[model samples]
Target: MNVPKASEKECIILTISGRVQGIGYRRSAQQKAESLGLTGWVANLENGDVRMVAEGTPDQVDALELWCRNSGPRMARIDRVEVVRQQASGVFVGFVIR
Candidate 1:
């Protein structure tokens, strides 16, 4: 098993389902993540879901997650949000849409 260093930032993978595609979900998420000083990527899945990987301070990640769960783009009708926490990779430079 890979142990995370105590100094490492927190990371999370969010899977959002329902009416998330073609509605600027990725763009909105990217902007939000950037605003929170997070580094990661958001992308559309073939199964009509949106996936986002984010790394930042715990507070920052939590804020972003709350935004995603409580409020998203005006056009997005999110039905569910699943979050998986993981060790931060320290590889991303900035948030991006993919």
Candidate 2:
């Protein structure tokens, strides 16, 4: 069985769609998350979406979400951002682009 060793309450999984791929979204998200002291990864989905999982304080997570909603990299046009809250696994060390 796979289980988290520690339960971090502030964690989020984001599915951001629309003009998010091939436009530095993953890298920019990584930088933003890292700067916010978040731990997790951002990657491009095969279906032209961007997926991000981040673990941090509620404020940090909110900040990241706000960034995604309002100000992604200049080139990206964000259409829909779906946010899912989950218990953090405390498994990541730093933010990265997957």
Candidate 3:
């Protein structure tokens, strides 16, 4: 993980749908988060959507969201990536696939 140089980290919550479930979306998200040095968890919802919480530099968060727009596991046909800015929880130690 590429640790940020400062403590002023940011956070964002993301909701994604369209072929997100049962397509390794969560795992792909976890990988992306880890590669970006973000701490968070990605999980599949019962509604066939995917949700994740990522915390890191603002630019990294933005990059992750952008990647979610259409990039992930090869089988994931991501249709959209909804982003919500929130206060950092400072709870996650590393990215996990849930």
Candidate 4:
């Protein structure tokens, strides 16, 4: 995936779908984001989807998306991922699983 050039601080909302619930998707995401020096939160939506908001440079955010697609924990089966660029909300200090 081509990484877009973003400002020094920016946020992107990503909606992930597939067999992502009841697995370690949220935790894995949190860990990965933290490792990548990103600030965000990931949660499992009631509709069997995973939602994440990651703030960082475009490269880091894009890298997280790439990792989530294939390296999501052992039980996750990610089918599709939808990402939307957005302004940073500055609500989180670290990556969290919510």
What TM-score would each prediction reach against the true structure?
0.91, 0.90, 0.88, 0.86
Which should have the higher lDDT, number 2 or number 4?
A: 2
CA displacement after TM-score superposition, residue 60 of candidate 3 (Å): 1.1
Candidate 3 lDDT score relative to the true structure: 0.85
Put down candidate 3 lDDT per residue, 4-88, tens digits, no spaces.
5436777899999888887777877888899888998888888888999989889889999989996888888877778898767
lDDT of 3 at 51: 92
Tens digits of lDDT, candidate 4, 1-98: 85334445679788999999988889888989999988989999999999999998877888998987778888888899998887666666888888
In candidate 4, where is summed lDDT lowest over 10 consecutive residues? 1-10
Ranking by lDDT: 1, 2, 4, 3
Tell me which of candidates 1 and 3 scores higher on lDDT: 1
> Taking the candidates one at a time, how many backbone clashes does each contain?
0, 0, 0, 0
Residue 61 alpha-carbon offset, candidate 3, angstroms: 0.5
Pairs clashing within candidate 2? none
Give the best candidate by TM-score.
1
Regions of model 3 farther than 4 Å from truth: 1-7
Query: Which candidate order results from sorting by TM-score in descending order?
Result: 1, 2, 3, 4
List the global CA lDDT of all models: 0.90, 0.88, 0.85, 0.85
**Model 1 regions lying over 4 Å from their true place:** 1-6
lDDT of 1 by residue, 1-98 (tens): 66344356889999999899988889999999999889999999999999999998888899999999988899999899999998788888889888
